[model samples]
Target chain A: MTTEIVIFAVLFLIVSGMGFVASRWRRPDDIASLNEWGLGGRNFGSWITWFLVGGDLYTAYTFVAVPALLFGAGATGFFAVPYTVIVYPLVMIVLIRLWSVSHVHGLVTPADFVRARFGSPTLALLVAITGIVATMPYIALQLVGIEAVLKTMGVTGDLPLIIAFAILAAYTYQSGLRAPALIAFVKDALIYVVILVAVIYIPTQLGGWGSIFDAAQAKFDKTPAATDGILLNANNQLQYVTLALGSALALFLYPHSVTGVLASKNRDVIKRNMSALPAYSVLLGLIALLGYMAIAAGVTPIGTDVNTVVPQLFDKMFPDWFAGVAFAAVGIGALVPAAIMSIAAANLFTRNIYREYINRDATDAQQASASKIASLVVKVGAVLFILLIDPQFSIDLQLIGGVIILQTLPSVALGLFTRWFHRAGLIAGWIAGMGAGMLMLYNVANPATHHDHFGGSAFALSKLGLDTKMTIYAGFLALAVNLIVALLGTVIAKSAKVVDGPDATRTDDYTADQGDPRVHDLEVTSST
Target chain B: MTTPRTDRSPWNWLLLLPIAIPLIPALFNAVEPRLFGIPLFYWLQLGFVLVSVAATLVVYHMTRRAR
Candidate 1:
């Protein structure tokens, strides 16, 4: 093996060791309850939540696919920056309410909140299924990040990925959420260092930032006019605004994002982290520029896999040792989110599906055990998903995931703000939103990639009989349909005096603080 | 939902500025006036992140006492 591969192996082994030893870090007497196993005992303070939620939100997809998008499509790829920028303020509005209410009832999943708020098992089930389905392909895409770095290192085939996920599954099963929470600290440290050096050092190796932007501008000047430019145009501008706003709205609705947020100990932990977590956006903005850096360095992607462009840039610019560190940063970045995602998915199953449907009498210990097993199944399923699909499809995995998850926003996010919508209305909205989203996605064809259906998130206005080639985000349109149907449905249902399900949550529950006496110790709602 | 300050705090309105600031095409659409070799398009959006942090901080500070 080359020195680069050796160094990367050593770092990977070290982080894997950290994952194994993480269960003992806090050393809970017994992690056989949902709160203890799935949420790190709900005691994480500000700094840990900052790292946890930040690490969870910004995954290997951000590292690999984002830069790749910038490298390929130019300016519109920058929607990620504004999306992340808006997400914090947007989340701070609704998520603090979620945190307060979840703590008061010891709710473990978004579905749990839905169950209590609407008193509708069916709506909760839909939200749970949506979260799981949306997150699965996203987990598979993380493997693509690791695969890109490994491919850059001249290692091919599926063995290495299988082995890496095996180790990740094992520790997550043993340690649950603590595994990812502990390793996030190390992941962020390495990512920060590598990105800091690459942004500062690599520019000097080239002419400078002046030439870098000039090179990028010059390259885009020669490309097609559709979304490819150093700046936005009228054709792509609507897409930029709608995509950023839609993604920001969808970020916290994902189960894994909620998992990270729900693990925080109190309102202040969330408050402080919401403001402080944008510190990473500074890194992400710099990281996005790595695409331009690759352009400046004349780094070409391996075999048209734009995902490999950033890793290829590292190999061509940084020394072998630092490249190994960068590779490990991305590889570990995948693992942290993957572990959390599996745990989050598993929690939804155990709490909302498995316990609710299969075994209503399951105790807290039984639920925790079920969650651990389900986490393993989730990781294995994600691994199989990557093996089966085109690894190049990582970009769309996230897009489709975003489109699917945004359907739940009307139920989960708007539900947090108001109880005006009937439960039946929320259920009908999910179906309408999901159906409309898929139909729109089914029509989005990317001729470049030769993907005929579900090819991208940007839907052409021409398809709807508009007089232009301009496009808007599919999720944005789907959300509009969802809201309209829900509004009309609520009016119809309320007027008909259709029996509304009983709401278990009190108004005060939305504002409950950490030390509130009403908050249950564990989510062992055996007979709610 | 009934909490007076949590739901109705006027300070909460400040948070909307950061979110709305970036949506305007006029704000960061130019290549002129680049910073450190970065264009206004790039640096300005990164600057919006700081804008959000500041807005969230002020809201949190102003409303924490009410909680």
Candidate 2:
């Protein structure tokens, strides 16, 4: 435990040192501008942006959760593998257009695009607030990942976590996007080393591949659980497929994801990233197998928490010193994504709400300062959420975030493809999607367990006399409803002679690449 | 003026080659033995690092050409 603490402490200092130095990496004379502070000067090349966004997307939760889920639920955990596989193709289709449109309109947040598209500040505010609300618990889940590692290392007390988050907030507040941008290189390097070492060395430590599988199958068969140790089953098939498709659609709609896309130098970079980023998925498949290995190794479930499985597996398999290094790897993994998510959420608040509503004529520096302060506030809020609320409950809430953010798809993702839906129709679609999504999510109960306050599933189609025995992720179903309502509303508005706003932006502008003089950075003011 | 005489082909569908390269081994592992003297799982995973680096380089070159 002391070794783990020492390694983590050293890692925290190193990460903070990187953050302080990152302010000068791009060497902007004034860090007050939103372009410099929030978006890292919008000058990231293919390699840096590739690592930054890749590191941002594939996170500690992934390192911990994918394996944990596989360990707990068997083959269903591999949903992460396929979901990631399809994400790039899905991103390739949508994000290039989003980048072009955002670049052309000087839009910093999706809500800014919504405001300009619909000429309704109210609708934009709704989108912005939805983004921030959805992003908050997601950030808290990163802390949950950190907490899982800490607990597995037998490190007690809240002081260490509080100190860790304080350091994270300080650097994030000081360095902004550049902090994550610089740290991503080191984070990816460490993760690759740890995972690689584990995949090879751990199997060798436990007998061999055949022994691991044989032991796992034997344990599952004798454990009195109905299902055996195999990957597929009649019960979980629906959940697996729907969860994957739903999560893939939800991934790029995240404000942080779009923020990453917008920071790129051109359209081709977006396309290249979309195609190339799935390289991590190949790594993800191997990571998922660690779950099965832990089961085979006679490692009893420690802490009764799924997230702690990987850390415990490490603690049992490796030396204390190496286990400390692995703990630091997972811990640092959480920080990179958590920092990016908070900044992205804060940008939505500053650009869409604080600037759009609170102070319309605010300078660029003011926007940057507001975003910085808001980011710290957001991180602190996430810390309070994880500490005060049940960590398991917060993780379940992040699944709900998956549902809520997916509701934005028709507006953000589909909007990138076409503008035929009227602003009124889009707003109506959003309200209905959100309303239906929340109601269904509220009613979802884990049938396996007895505690019934707001189970993660929205509506059990089974109760409606539907023949299907599968549970659908409520957000995916809500978006289907959103699309139908949006189309009908579009037709109604077209026939009713509603006043349409002037189309200041055209579809072709989205297809436009870099070197267009119209796309330029906006300067900002420091709020403090 | 930008040169616009010939070669208006869409920017190398082969630029998408990196995405598919990983899947090839994923397909191979579906039915094979002794990849690098380890089972399909370990070899395929360690192989991804090398594959990712190679693909990243390929992508970097392709993207650089477009610039």
Candidate 3:
């Protein structure tokens, strides 16, 4: 009925149609194959991989959450900008090795790689379950961004979300990786246009940077918090740096991030993508400035839900129709990444857990089928995460994910470079890291607001009773504990002469060309 | 993993500039002057994006040729 609604409806119809038809965009002759269906035949070129990985890594959440945090917290939120910038170099170190090893071993998930790397299926199973648990809420958070846009447009009923997700599910089921990969192209294009326009347009309307900075400074100075605006200060600087470093380490470990890596055709593609991917961080910095721009424009922070600030700013600044277009950009942005993450998580469940534990000798067809079914279930779980439970719970769960995935860095990232850590030691490290991180996170609470649910700091030196306030992410502390314990455990294991399975079949295998005859693609399916 | 270079390229050292350009303003907030009819803070930050793009393009080309 309203102009915003009309524009949104038209945009939704177009995107939904793309979602449905996306299932057929790169149809393989075989419909039942996981490699063909889940992974787009593992043959994306540089350009497609660039867009797909970019879209997956930078979500609507980044667009919304980063700016929202900047809008609310000031300079502290800028850590995201730096974390994204350094992520490329960090990824460059690990992913190339991961590509070689995974390519050589034909590993589908990081857990699979761990299984081969350590010759310990139990360790691999823990890694697999961790990936799934961490990713589920991430998928849900994507929906929250979409939900904010819909709620702003006055589309409150569950029907639209259900319908929209139904379409996403159908297309993803139909097309697998190609569905999200193709949709990512559209998603990134729209985001680029919207952000470019906002950066240029919003400033002029708000009377430029001088007024914005003054307004923000004035507001923050008067507030009880010592710092003005969202920038980090002495109180939070350690938290900022540690959180950024910890996050960069954790980013590539996510199943979806690995999914992007494994989908690349060869080592060269992986290397090229790593060097090129930092470009998104540049975009992210510009994106982060929208928070400051909003401050200058006198944009009021949206209530409770931080994701709505950008959408609200668009609605207030742009005409109703263009706002709808921007809304569609944000809405569709969530869809592309959510689809990929679900599929990646589902693949982990099928290959590592279901087949390894539930049925030892499941055929490739059965594995593929299991993943497909599991993907649907994953989507359903994500939907309930947002729709049934409090959205804040899911966001907090995402923070927990930050801690959860960091535990893998000791295993996956370190394993990429060396086997010195020992198999038993790596397993001990993972458990110790996980347990310490969770307990610290559980004990973390912000006393000021009485909001106790999501209080995990990147690190708090004060908590450990050191005189100097050395801020670090809780994950880093957990990781340190892991390393110490693992070292002790390894020395003990070595002294005892415990049996260690042979190192993954071929370390040299990773260095081989993708065209090698030994490189055979495997498909997985599950029997109902 | 690829072997670490024994001799690092000066160009790789130059890579740090693009990363630092945006932060320089914060460090020298007292003296930096405005440019292009835009405030110093705004213009410097915008320049960071341009520098990042150029640097990213360079990295992409270099990596592609490394093969």
Candidate lDDT values, in order: 0.83, 0.70, 0.70
True contacts kept of each: 0.69, 0.00, 0.11
Distance from true location, Cα of A253 in model 1, Å: 0.6
lDDT of 1 at A346: 87
Order of models, best DockQ first: 1, 3, 2
Clashes of each: 0, 10, 27
Q: Cα lDDT of model 1 overall?
A: 0.83
Q: Quote the positional error of residue A40 for candidate 3 in Å.
A: 1.8
Write candidate 3's Cα lDDT for A1-528 as tens digits. Answer: 288888877876787677667656665666576666677776667688777777865676677767776776666666665566656655654676777666566777899888887888878988998898778767777777777787677666676567557766876777677777777777788888988898788878888756666666666777885533434566666666666667777778999888777667765576567666666665676677777777776776445666677777888899998898888888888888888888889888987898789987776677778888888988787777565434232234455567888888877888777777778988898899889987787666644335553453545577788776555678768878888888888888888998775676565655554665655443321112
Q: First chain of model 2: TM-score?
A: 0.92
Top-down TM-score ranking: 1, 3, 2
Give the clash total for candidate 1.
Answer: 0
> Root-mean-square deviation of each candidate, in angstroms?
2.4, 4.6, 4.2
The top-ranked prediction according to TM-score is: 1
Cα lDDT of model 1 by residue, A1-528, tens digit: 277798888998998888778788777777888767887776776677777788865687788888888888888888888988899888888898898888787786899999999999999999999998888777877877887888889877766576667777777888888888888989888888988899899999998899999999888988765568879999999999998999888889989888777767667667778888776788788888889999999999888678899999999998889888888888888888888888888888887898889998888788899888887777777776565544333666777778889999987898888899998888888889999998998898866566677667888989999999798999899998888888889999999999999998988789777666776544343223
Question: What is residue A413's positional error in candidate 1, in angstroms?
Answer: 1.1
TM-score of 3: 0.87
Better by lDDT, candidate 3 or 1? 1
Q: Any runs in candidate 2 off by more than 4 Å, and if so which?
A: A157-164, A222-229, A380-397, A446-450, A454-459, A517-528, B1-67
Q: What are the models' TM-scores?
A: 0.95, 0.86, 0.87
TM-score of chain B of 3: 0.54
